[model samples]
Target: MIKWVAAFLGYFIFRFPGAVLGFIVGSLFDNMGGSNGGGRNVFQDLTRQSVSPADFELNLLSLCSIVIKADGQVSQRELDYVRQYFLSTYGKEKANAIFRTFNDVIKKREVSAQRICSYLVQRTRYEVRLQLLHFLFGIAQADGQVSKAEVIKLRELAGYLRVGQHDFESIMAMFIKSADNAYKILEIEKTVSDDEVKKAYRTMAKKYHPDRVVTENEAIKKGAEEKFKEVQKAYEIIQKERGIS
Candidate 1:
């Protein structure tokens, strides 16, 4: 009966913080010959080791570094976006540590892509991994443009993340659609009609333009096409509504 009670307690400890800490504590008690033998000692050790930093943080930082470097140049906008996301997702204290770790990895200048991808694969959950990829896409579009280099890097990361090509293409489409919608919301136009459109275009263009969102990239021209279309549409809509045309 005493042995049964001790074994039950051991099982309860293993369930929460897991087998690693359980194993250690259990072993100490086992060494003292207190209870149900050492049935879970091995399991506890295994669980504890499994919770190491290699399981999560390392891989997260590796992926984040790769993402920030997706564009040929890392702009202030990209940095700011990354910082904001980290703060929101991890809270300020942890976010600062994460940013520091990510910056350190990126600054190494000698890290291999395979090494980075391997870390990401080992540490991150699939959904969180996808979110990181989307964040990179956002940074690429932040500058109101996407460069060929940035696109290629994004594609490479997608592949490395094991996300399907179709999904990647879908994400690109979404970015284009968002830029288009933003233009419409601002009521800007392709051509100047009164100083209002010109001013509105300048302001709206600045706001939704990819360059302002990240650093400028030539590849973003394709995404910009949608923005242009939206501007044209808004101009038409406004003109018709206000009897300007």
Candidate 2:
């Protein structure tokens, strides 16, 4: 549909900037669908700003393959995690089919996380990329603990994805809980005062707030909600320990 419109516009309009604008707007309209009776969608203005939803899912799955292979061997639990993610995000029938085909492609390809992630970071939004890292961490910790090699690779991947050190550590804290892990979850130092902890909690709570993705698709919005909940849990844990209301 977008291609048809672009082609027609290119043939008829046959102008430089006009044709280009037509192409871009056509693409956005295709993504927005006819749901609005030609009314404005909140995402229409930003549709061409990033990859389409399908491409986003593909990029996420491709990167996940590299993360799953980080420890040199894939475990049943790890595979199950991927399946479960698909099952929940997609549905049972589609998830099983996608898992089968996705497994085949990843099995045949030898992908480097850095190489692919470098490309993704340029085009993908920060929140979407963070969700990919979130999924990767979930997969790595599926069996119990994240391996040393996995952590190294995940950290490297985080770097390639342009995820900030504090954000990466905060996500990591969700999966790996140590004695002082709560501080990491809040992206604060342990030496900070009670007031500082409260402040950090407020800052993180705003940073990971699900409402930030409210304009996104349902699945992506749900991922943000999960992140928001993790932040809340960490804050609650610290609040209980510090005897703060």
Poorly placed runs, candidate 1 (over 4 Å): 1-55, 122-128, 177-245
The TM-score of candidate 1 is 0.47
Worst 10 residues of 2 by lDDT: 39-48
Q: lDDT tens digits, residues 1-245, model 2?
A: 88567856775776666667777878877866743332222222223254554555566677778778888887889889988877876689878877886687568557666767876776657876677788789899998889998999899999998999999999998888799888898999888899999999889888778776646456566767888888888878888988988
Point out the worst 10-residue segment of candidate 1 by lDDT: 40-49
**lDDT of candidate model 1 versus the reference:** 0.56
Candidate 2 positional error at 73, Å: 1.1
Q: Write the per-residue lDDT of candidate 1 for residues 1-245, one digit (tens) a residue.
A: 33444555666876544544555665666554443233221111112123344335565556556666766466777677767766755579877987887778777665566766665566444433444566678777776777677888788888887766644654555465553443334543334356675477556546445443221222333344454455556556655655763
Each model's lDDT: 0.56, 0.76
Candidate of highest lDDT: 2
- Model 2 residue 128 lDDT score: 65
